[model samples]
Target: MGHWWDRNIIEPGKLPLLLALAAFVLTFLITRVVTRLIRAGKGPFGNVTAGSVHIHHVVPGVVLTVIGGFGAVASGRHGFGPALSAVIFGIGTGLVLDEFALILHLDDVYWSEAGRKSVEMVVLTAALVGLLLAGFVPFGVNDLSEDELQNRAGAVVSIGVNFLFALIALSKGKARTAVFGVIIPVVALIGSLRLARPGSLWARRFYRRRPRARARAVLRAYHHDRRWAGPRRAFGDWLGGKPDPPHPLERD
Candidate 1:
């Protein structure tokens, strides 16, 4: 055991770690971008951003999964095993959170959106719990070949997450948006492993498809609001009874 662990499993490679770190940084930036794009205003980007509250939150989870997966793979552990499993865990966990959040009415403070999110969250959360426990638990790192476990876990988690996301997206879709989002992630998640490429490649491409116009704008707004605190910001902060910074456009 020690011989194999030392011989085939542990290798000195900074490439994977570098790659994972890059993915993490990219994920945070990309998430901010997506959030901004959605929140910029009521054009295509703004609408997408608002609607994305339903899907966009998964971006961080997906990013983390890829980082973990690639790190495992780069460590000279096994075929694309750890990375893939991590992806599954990521997507699955994201989905579970989304669904549960919605059902629990944690989607927002507003009553209407919260109601909708609560119901959706309940149904999806139940489904996710059942699927994950039954399918993904056995495919741990210590058990199967690295790639096999990763593939299995990735597939299970992605499917579970996408299933929930797809349900919401499709049911309330605008010209099949859900289908497009699901396809992009699915193809990228599965295909990247085969090429021994990191999943962040897909995430980067996904966000890159449209420049983060809204995100950039929102960031600008956020900064502006921070510099010049005003009446509206004060009122809003008071109303919310929370010392949160004002949104840029919300300032005045």
Candidate 2:
């Protein structure tokens, strides 16, 4: 285990990245716990307010992100300075992404259904970073043989094909698949072969003339959402607290 860590992480100068990932996940978890406590009114933690306005954590997050980003760039990849800067950047990222929904809608909706997007984004970011730390290279270039890498044409062709698959998956509204596909070409290939989502650009452009294909796509979407939505929501709620009850007008 120690040898693997040294070879895969230390030798590759990935310690800062690992530190950043750890810090990001830890900061998010801590922020969630504090916010949940405030929501329940069970702790001394309270919202930061100034006069008539409430100060969101994203403010400080932006500040830290700027500082850490520049600091990391200046510190270089080796030594403790880079690692510390990485941690700071990670913390800033956590705070910023926690309020992502609020930024998107320009309103306070922390406990509303819209706020769930923040949790989803956080999870996605963490997953991608984790994959990177686990040695998955973006654009599927890591799978190339040494000889193929030396052949510039072969490398370019491989990358181009993989990128096409990712693009197709994105057009089909398979965002997660597209994202992971950048690191693993097979994932993108699978996504490209799947039916497009009903509301996606691919469906509108390609499935428009094919009524049967459209119907099948819609049906697949419905069943897929029905099967996974509940578990996905449950996991989100477990991590970020359940959303507030809907308003009466919304229910109506």
Per-residue accuracy of model 1 over 1-252 as CA lDDT, tens digit each: 976544442453222333333343344334334434454543355322554454445445646556655555564645665545444444434433433334354444322323234233333444434333233331132334667556977656645665555444343322123433344344223332221111233334443454564355346546755776565445433322223244577678
CA lDDT of 70 in candidate 1? 59
Candidate 2 residues 22-78, lDDT tens each?
A: 888998899999999999999899999999899999999889889889999999866
Give candidate 1's whole-model lDDT: 0.41
- Model 2 clash pairs are none
How well does candidate 1 score on lDDT at residue 247?
Answer: 57
For residue 153, give model 1's deviation from the true position in Å.
38
lDDT of 2 at 25: 90
The TM-score between candidate 2 and the true structure equals 0.97
